[model samples]
Target: MAVFQAVRANQEESMRTLGQVKPWCAGILVGTVLAAGSLVPSSGFAQESVSVRAALVKGALPADDPSASAWNSTPASEFPMSPQVHWPNRIQEVTVKSVKVRALHDGQQIAVLLEYEDPSQDPDDAAGLEFMVGDKKAHFAHGQPMAQVQGGPVNIWYWKNKDNNALDMNAQGFGSLKVQDQQDVKAKGVYQNGTWKVVFSRALSTPDVEHDTQIKPGDFINIAFAIWDGKKLESGDLKEKGSQKAVSSWWYFRADPPPDYSAYYYVALAVGLAAGFQFVIIRKLKKGATS
Candidate 1:
């Protein structure tokens, strides 16, 4: 008890000098909340089930151009290429066809398999969604293609370069067999089946990590299917390079995070407190000299 008190006192004192007391306090509060086994999120880390619905829109796409892939090619990072996950323009024309979510440790997620039809009859290369597993990019394609990662592999990730009409490992497709971070969710596109299909999956863990431990039963999961016009990539484009313009899909994973620290609010509060303290000190000295 004494040691714990001493540690708490030290944490408090550190905030005073560092002008980070509030953030520290907030962090502590958040930590306590999680430790007490009371799970909830103030924002991004909130534990709840998110459902998404994306049915064909009115004249969604002309049946004549059913082969056309949505999207107009964006950076490797970001989706529809938006930083915000819930952005309106990010990915549209999507719906939660089906969702099966479970818990994995402190985090939860929704796992699903999306299917898009490739109405395009001609063979075309596909530049599917690109998700980040750490710094590495997970490119999805109609047929699996070459891969290189700046960090470690997403463990259970792989792509089949087989140029089959359907994106089957027993067929052909590229995706993150493993997921590093929810923020790492990237974008890819391809025309598959008799229409264009782009599948997206998001797995989030409260722990700040690129990937999280696997999922177990009873964990709450959130799922959404956004519809985004497939960003068209040139034949030379990465998403559409090899066998482009087929169907695209991505699989995200939840990895484990080391048990430490507090919630994001605490971190933000700590920073805010530090900033406020610095501001107060500066003004305090100025006023003191004037007085």
Candidate 2:
């Protein structure tokens, strides 16, 4: 009879100990499973990409307004700029160290806002957006040499502070810049408090497909930039002199696609599975403790 009592006491203690550990075990299992689920490539668990995203908006985009309230809704992608040293008339000094870029799309048109600091608002100040074409692989400086035009061509949307609109241009090499016959790019710029704000806007697709880098929604494209500070006498038209400018390397630009809710469903499924697994494990532990 004494031996029986001892065995009963031992079983009771074991059950109590298991009861104390049950919750902790279940919590650990659930935590680990959920952490793994979060890593799944679902929209709910997706991280931001390294490209400049043009967010789609319901209302009209602020085409030429740098201070428009519509622009406040989008996030900015800041890129560092360096002196253009690949070609002749290279920038000896870097005046513009960085540029803050924001983009918006209204399904039909897109607008890009570029803001940078400049101590003086020089009349010769100009900004440009350049993208690759043809082979889509060439020197980012502008393009390959004219003799090697078959290598690739580049489309440029050049905007000057003195002009009411941006110029549609193209180039194959350093001194091979030419204005396009079709002008579809529009731009406006404002300077205040030692800062310059410029906005460039155009239709998502243009008829001049030969010379324009046609932009499409939900597409990834390579792009570069240049800024000519008039105070420094940087010139885009005169390749022989004053060609020094701040430039950027190739970067990606993408228009955000429509929302996908399938990821939410997957996340919900994963959470359900984790809860079910925890319940099963706890049930087995409880059964063992009781027995």
Which candidate comes out best when scored by TM-score?
2
In model 1, where do residues sit more than 4 Å from their true spots? Answer: 1-111, 114-121, 127-150, 155-162, 165-194, 198-239, 242-291
lDDT accuracy of residue 241 in candidate 2: 25
Candidate 2 residues lying further than 4 Å off, grouped into runs, are 1-50, 145-150, 232-242, 276-291
**CA-lDDT, candidates in order:** 0.33, 0.80
| lDDT by residue (tens digit), candidate 1, 68-88 | 342111111111221212312
Pairs with backbone N, CA or C atoms under 3 Å apart (clashes), candidate 2: none
Candidate 2 least-lDDT 10 residues: 233-242
